[model samples]
Target: MSERRRRIGDGLAVLAGARPDVLAAAPGARQRFVALGGVLLSTGALAAVSAAFAVGMALGVWWPLAVLVGLGWGAVVVNLDRMLLVGMAHDSSLKRNLVMAVPRVGLALVLGVVVATPLTLQVFSKEIDTEIVAMQAEAADAHRVALESDSRFAGLPDLRERIATQEAVVASGGVADPGLAVVRAGVTEKQAAYDRAVTLQRELDAKAQCELDGTCGTGDAGTGEAYLQARAAADAQTAVVTAARAELDTAVAAVAAAEGRSAALAGSSLDADRAELTRLTAELDRQQAAFDVENEGSGGILLRLEALDRLGGRNMTLAAAQFMLSLLFMCVEVLPVLMKLLLNFSPPTAYDRLVQLRDSGDVELEEMAQESRRTVAQAKEELLVLAERERVDRQKEAILARRRAALAEVAARTEAARAQPEAPAAEEPAEAPRQLWDTGPIRELARSAAVRTVRSVRRRPADRTPTTV
Candidate 1:
């Protein structure tokens, strides 16, 4: 258990960018860094879960892929947080610390919002789902209304009404032809006349029988002139009734023929109108079906977010709860950076002091190394200059020695020539002075001096041998 605890502490220290060697020296700093690491780890874990939920809901990706994406996101978040923590070194100057921390805090705030939103959405998933359903219905209705208002389907309602009117006409057996209506009216009047005639005839026949039997009406016992007149009228009414019935049959046939003709004419137009109406209705239905398919199940992250917003607006309690929850999550995300900043503002901890000390020590060590290199380079340059001066001085002394020897040799040769007899002019020739000037010893000395000077110049300071006088 102690070993495991130590390992865990080491891991956390590494996570917080703390040096284990340094941390071991200062045990006081270990717990602080360990706590910071815990915050970082929790933040990363939350980020992963939030990212997974967001990816799954927003992109509708496969679960395994979403999990992979979540893991990657968590790693990135951990790296970012680690960078933030590591970059904020303990500083003595409050102003410098603030300057360094401001941008990091701002970045953390942005990250916090990004990480919190998805978790917040997940928290209110049920409410968001319900709101999303309502929103989808509203969107569908709006789209339907927009489609109906489109010019292509603008005449749809008129077509339906026109088709209905035409259908009614066709079903009613005929068009409203004036000639047919007149014929029907005439047939009706003739039938009425025939009915009246038949009734009169029956009454007349009854009255005649009653008079012959001497029952009532004329008070006569036998058939008289009145009875005979009534009988004749009865006979005339029977003829009228028969004629009326014949005319009624003819009119009925004419009306039937007219109805057939009218029905045929109207049926053709109704069929054309009905076909157009069906085509228009089918087109509208097709468009509506496509619209439905396009917008079906549109519960993406954006939609859910919008739903959450709407839910918040409709209920103050929910709004407050959502706000509080979001704030809580964001606070968690921002805690590490804020913690680092607060620690920076406070009196330096032993860990912070050690980190500062180690960092300063590293700086001092680098500076010392650079200065040493510069001093070495300067010494080397000075040594080369001194060696060059020595070589030049030696060459000058060798040249002087050669010059003195040549002068001495010329003086000796002149004195010897004077002591000896004057040589024959022909034997000496006119080139004697030139020969004296270009003597062997002097040339040898010049040659030796030249060789020695070349050797001396070519040799390094360490390799140089002393010149012979």
Candidate 2:
């Protein structure tokens, strides 16, 4: 005899508020729960800190304790959850199970506090004096000390000796010291020397010209006027020479600028092409990373595509499976209703038309039951296939969406890079480059590793068989 009837009796015991377990609480189970609760709270906190530490390390920090704590925390917390679940199964009443599920939630909240507390502590504990500010202060102090150093004072004598030599040169020429005279005159003393030289040179030249050509009317000209004309001519010649020097400098600057531009134009397009390739490669990498997140069994692009096709075929069969499962769950939900209908629609006291139909010595009624059984069997087979297909498809779509989003992000970044300036040539100076132009070694290293992995994977002939471990 099937125990469906006995099972119903047990359900009634539960509903009637009778003791459902042998003990009010299982002693062994209770101790396990307490231990799990404590460990989860403690270890979970430590794990968060460890994970944060690991992230910092990856970013070039060297906090060893974080890695140790994170590994320990993760291991302890995982085992703690498992142990807690085992203890929870001791009494196994649906009502009690529901209440105990809440502990895990509480444990999670407490762990959050653990992670947050350390960060708060770090923020508060930061050094009051910054290294940059301290360094600047030290620099200023050093500069002041340099001004007062014996080394600085020693150099002053050499400077004074040069000044004395200049003074002697001025005195020998019967001229005042230009530097001192300028201060007294409230004008540059060099102007007086220039004026005298111009006047004298003109006077000499004018007299000599008249003597040479025999036509200059100023041969017997006064020395003062002759000096003035000579000075003007000399000033004009000096101005011409200065202008020529300035033009030469300007030409040199223009030539250097043009050479730089020409060299840059020749190399820029190659850098741009390299940058674009880098962006495309990055996008492909991101897509693959996203695909991995779903952790589906899809092994490659070709495998994923094939799985997608299989999913569609599986979906076509789902409609039939759904019909069967719907029927089965409905049967469970309304089993009481069915039992009531069978036992108490009040079996006819006298055989009525309906009773006559069911009792007709009826071979046809028996055949109808057999047909119903066949239908149920076919429905079940279809349902199983549908269930398996759906599971596969759902995993595939999740993986696909992740990969798609990753790919899109990579593409956007790469396309944006096109508008950005290319990294300068290796021969170029570092100060001249922008951040976007720096691809950073990490991106390159990851790419090379990926390439090597793919090449290794390709070297072996692929097995068409599904992976089994």
> Estimated TM-score per prediction?
0.69, 0.18
Model 2 lDDT tens row, 1-469: 4598545444443322222342123223233224334444444555556456444423434667656656676666545444444333222254654465556445544544444433332332222113223433554455444443545343444544544544453344313333334233422333454555556556666655554454565555444565466556656756654554455455545544444443444344435544554564465455545544433322232332233334435575533443454444333322322222232234333212333444464778788999999999989877866675566566556655655565565556656766776664667675655466344554465456556544544543233222221
For candidate 2, the clash count comes to 3
Overlapping backbone residue pairs in candidate 1 total 0
lDDT of 1: 0.82
| CA RMSD per model (angstroms) | 8.4, 46.1
Q: For model 2, state the Cα shift of residue 166 in Å.
A: 17
lDDT of 1 by residue, 118-213 (tens): 999999999988888788788889987887789987888887876666566568776454447787897799888878878888898898888787
- Report the poorest 10 consecutive residues by lDDT, candidate 1: 431-440
**Global lDDT of each model?**
0.82, 0.45
Worst 10 residues of 2 by lDDT: 120-129
The best candidate by lDDT is: 1
**Can you give the lDDT of residue 3 in candidate 1?**
100
